[model samples]
Target: MSTGVWIDQIGIDLDAGTQQVDEAIVVMHSAFVEYGHQGQASGAMVETADSLRAELSTGTRLGLARIGGQAVAMVKYRTADGGTLYFGRLAVSPEARGRGLASALVRALRGAARDMGLGGLSCSVRAAETRNIMIYEHLGMAIIGREDRRSLTGAVIPVVLMRDV
Candidate 1:
């Protein structure tokens, strides 16, 4: 099926771990360049991916969203303290934006979390990612915390807002 027609049609699986990690890095690199070009910074992107891959490699769950049998979007979540789902590395290609793919993927994440007996979902994003922050907000995610001037890779990163689903 074409991508548009597959909007919000997501499937979850416990497999595909290694490939997902590989794909996450690829998509993240592209997204980093895109988001960074808009001023989010390249170092932040690399550090974020490295940190995520390290954790996701073990005890992490993945959700893949496909179009025409090609993987187009992905969501990764880790079991956190109190059994909360700590969501991460949600990336959709720039060409795939505005398709409601990200929202659909999050819904899939919540469903998977619920199946695992998790209470809710949570995630952190760059505070300056206003577009992403707004999208998450519109999807019913509420900001619960924020960090300012945090340094990573020897450079200061601003505003990491935590959200709950």
Candidate 2:
């Protein structure tokens, strides 16, 4: 029951060459920066366009959300081994939080993964981001493990790995 946005018009599995590529990147950068400023993201951050393009070249899919032609949220998904869809860079605009948009995007990613015969959808959340963890947990995702991500600046990010089971 999300409002102020339309889901039917989103572009799935988009390429870097798409016209909205810049928009998608903006959504990611803004949302990630919001989380970072709130002390939720200590060291982990999305890389530059060159790395993103390389990831897209490896079959990563971007899930974009737009309302009235404005990009609001996005996530990157890639099919991992043994049919698991790994997702990252999930972000929702500051104005769009608490409206079920994140959950909707998760549902959309789950559906897309299932459509591809993927066993499940998986993602990593910074361990200190309890708000994020609870949101995903409420959506039926369980923490499966932990991972340590070393940022380019050499900061260690403790992350919780979760998967829909």
Candidate 3:
């Protein structure tokens, strides 16, 4: 019943706990600081250990990537309608970029989704974040649609919805 993956020496724990969640939060905030600087609101910017713990209690799963025992990336995911695994808040520390951890985590989750009889993986990426869109596209996911969502700060965030082929 263990959910984990090792790729290129990075360890991904799918059933991470509070301590790991705390570490992941640090990584997330650090990674998403750009949004704050851009005067945009990101849910990842507001996540706390308690809030994420609440999410876990409600069946959302967290995946953390660690290198040398330090958290460097994380993602939150859950089963969604249409038999797809919906993942979001995928963040990698600035220092951890170019290591393929993001793609590795998605690959691992794709396996988990398949094990659960899910059809595919899906996620919403900010339309402005072309790098993330390209990364997902490289993983075989295609843009299905786009939508504008209101952030907590009332900013209209345009996001591209993607699904794996």
Candidate 4:
């Protein structure tokens, strides 16, 4: 199926509680397992699930991209630096890979941030994750700082980027 068709098969909804977030967490864990071991670095931490659940339960905004009545992707953010939005834990399902879902989700997030009158959005990405770094750069994010020795989940990660809305 085409990208539009695949996207159309799903509904993007603002999840109201932790249940939906938990489901998305399951998918994300599995996806990481499938894609993580082969990468240059370890993937996300399973401990992140609890924090994600908490974020969903209490956050001002929580979104899920549901495909065929199932949560296939999730994106969430928080206000940082007073008005700067920090986005993290954006994940898409393995079954839904290469369908432009991540880009679509990020676009939606930028729109939401704009409507909220936020000055900009920021995220930290691993320097080794070239594909994701490329996507963020392509979306107009610019690197602002680099951390040399910090490890996100035991793997060296680098570079914080911010983009004005």
Name the candidate that leads on TM-score: 3
For model 2, name the residue pairs that clash.
Answer: none
Q: How well does candidate 3 match the true structure in TM-score terms?
A: 0.94
Collision pairs in model 3: none
Please, what are the lDDT tens digits per residue for candidate 1 over residues 1-165?
A: 111233445443433465566666666566566655665565536655556566666787665666656566766778888677777768786766777878887766666667778876788877777888888888778888787564454556666655555
Q: Please give each candidate's TM-score.
A: 0.77, 0.82, 0.94, 0.77
Candidate 1: where is the Cα deviation over 4 Å?
Answer: 1-15, 39-54, 149-152
- In model 4, the runs with Cα more than 4 Å from the true position are 1-10, 39-43, 57-61, 148-155
What lDDT tens digits, residue by residue, belong to model 4 across residues 1-165?
Answer: 011223345566543356665776666675566446665444454436677676566654556777677777776677777586777667788888887777776766666667678876777765666788778878878777767544446656555554643
lDDT at residue 162 of model 4 (Cα atoms) = 47
- Model 2 agreement with the true structure over 34-107: per-residue lDDT tens digits: 55666555332556656666767778766677665677877777888757888888888878777676877887
lDDT of 3 by residue, 1-165 (tens): 358778889998987866577787899899988898887868777778889889888988889988998899999999998789999999999999999989989998898888888998999999999999999999999999999987755678999999999
Q: Candidate 1's C-alpha lDDT?
A: 0.65
Candidate 1 least-lDDT 10 residues: 1-10
Candidate 4 residue 50 Cα shift, in angstroms, is 3.8
The reply for model 3, stretches above 4 Å from the true place, is none
For each candidate, C-alpha RMSD in Å?
A: 4.6, 4.2, 1.3, 4.8
Where is model 2 more than 4 Å wrong at Cα? Answer: 1-17, 35-46
Clashes of each: 0, 0, 0, 0
